[model samples]
Target: MRVRVATTILGITAALLAVPACSTDTAPPARTEKPAEAARQAAPLSSATLETRLLDESDLGEGYLRKPERPSQHNDVTVIGCPSLSELGGDAATGGTLSFPRNAKADFTYGGSSSEVSEELYSDNAAKLSHGIDRIFDATTSCPTYQVLAGGTPIDMASQELPAPRGLGDEQWSQLLTFSTGDRSTVVKQTAIRDGSLLLIVSGSPALVDRHLDKALAKATTTS
Candidate 1:
């Protein structure tokens, strides 16, 4: 599975954590309850509103420092040797991650530690929000193990589906990704949860993501 396939576009920074996580073996289908999600839909919030809701240095408490937000940019990542993705066509870019018109994000570092965590919020119609995360999860199953070419550098990537944090939202998707190039390996955990028209994506070191997942979600769903 792609452990921290972090280039994930959600964070563009997911794979906009910006990130995506995975393992080596095939992953199961993402779990979603479409009918239930639609029934609970909340009015989609604007980007400005989501910005106010973004988790800040204080939200993460002590030891976690907010990193400067990077401007969103186009990613030219290409996936190689994934037959299913190839069959789907137009699915090549971003290794299956996506972007949205109304979104806000933040990145953070823990003390001086090199490890970081990220939060991304997306607001759109329910269908688009659901589809956005679904595409990334789809890649985990279709390209369990594949090669990613980032700036002409060959990166070996693998992904394994992780169980979503149960009952976090109307629907959820989770995975772990491992990115390797030579002796270096990075593991990232990505979990995307949606409530109404809002989608919250969190990615980074597995433990940190787990620690902050609930907090991030709570903030995103709170009514203004």
Candidate 2:
């Protein structure tokens, strides 16, 4: 069975928002660009614009096909069967999300292969957006190893930090996850890029993510 990993981060913002307001930890430094300037630099993406920028079936090689687009109203983490975002942190809403899937179905013992390109745009102020990203980064540091139950089967997932790819966005961080069950294993790589006010997430196999990075960046630049 193919597992759906897109819904993982919906509740993360809410959970993260639950954190006590009096915490003494300092927020990450503000970006050189002001919020208003960043917003002006990249206008928010419309549904129509997003559809045009999504990678088409022809973009992937033979055996790879484009799945229907199912955009969400929240961000996603890599956990397959996570029950709640509080497991990660925060209790308030965060951002809007859009996902494009390119899948390869195989009859092998393990489930078929799949990949996704997701974009999250934070409508909140720059401080909130930066704070949200910072919280995500900090959360990843503590939960390196975790498990989620998919269809009653426990899926083992592991997370590791990856250096950002060059020249794509203002700031970037990646999470490499390995999901395994029995003899079947899948590698889901996710890279998050903060370009102006948009958080572009590329997820799938490492090769797939790499292949789409430049295209994603180019399209993101045209978000006016």
Candidate 3:
């Protein structure tokens, strides 16, 4: 049961897209006049290829693209959901999904999410994807329990259960997180997979967002 939904961003600030390299000061030794060695060194290992493409309104999958009435500078965001695949992009056979965005040279902004739950408990297995906007959530947040998997391998699960005196209702679990990271404030909703797990991803610049990690926990009373 995989379903997709869309969200809006008031004003978006594209995060830093460049991945941080290791902080190493060691330099390579000077090359000798060896013809064979010089030729091998000159040969490129990897080609200068484009990495990402921006998703525009016209470029999104049918019925998956949406634009707010009041348009803004960072208004281009296309989201998709597939339970069997990462929301980002990679191949299914080799765990990868591809997105042919608008242009090759453009710095694209995107997020990834996936979740699984027991059919007996949850109505639909749903996932959410949002772009062009950061999550908005309060400083004090409550995350729901979710299953975790690494490369299709079952890892663990995560939960948010309080003492009997203070417990949240099921409806509250669907509420979004109100938080501000750097120049953006974001709110992300939690989707529980009755006896399954979910993955919410975030990527961009520090000025926009930071770590994109999955929160997992194991429950004491497992669902059938």
Winner by lDDT? 1
Q: What would the per-residue lDDT of candidate 1 be over residues 1-224, giving only the tens digit for each residue? A: 12223244522223322222332343454565556556665678889999998889889888988877666555565667766554544533354434677889887888655678888899988777887677757755556778777666777877777767777888888887777768766778778888889989888888888898999999888876
Q: Summarize candidate 3's per-residue lDDT along 1-224 as a digit string, tens digits.
A: 22121222211122221222111121321211222222221111111121111233234223322222233232222221223212322222121111112102222233221211110111112211111101221101122322222223321222222111112111111222223333443333232211111112222222222121111111111222
TM-score of 2: 0.59
- Supply the TM-score for candidate 1: 0.82
lDDT tens readout by residue for model 2, 1-224:
12234334422222212212211122332223234344434444454554555545555445555444344343443344333323433342122122222211111011223334333333333344555665665454345666655445665765566666645566666666666566666655566666665556666556656776777667655645
Better of 2 and 3 by TM-score: 2
Tell how far residue 66 is off in model 2, in angstroms.
1.1
Compare the candidates by TM-score and give the number of the best one.
1
Residue 177 deviation, candidate 3, in Å? 1.4
CA-lDDT, candidates in order: 0.70, 0.46, 0.21
Ranking by lDDT: 1, 2, 3
lDDT of 2: 0.46
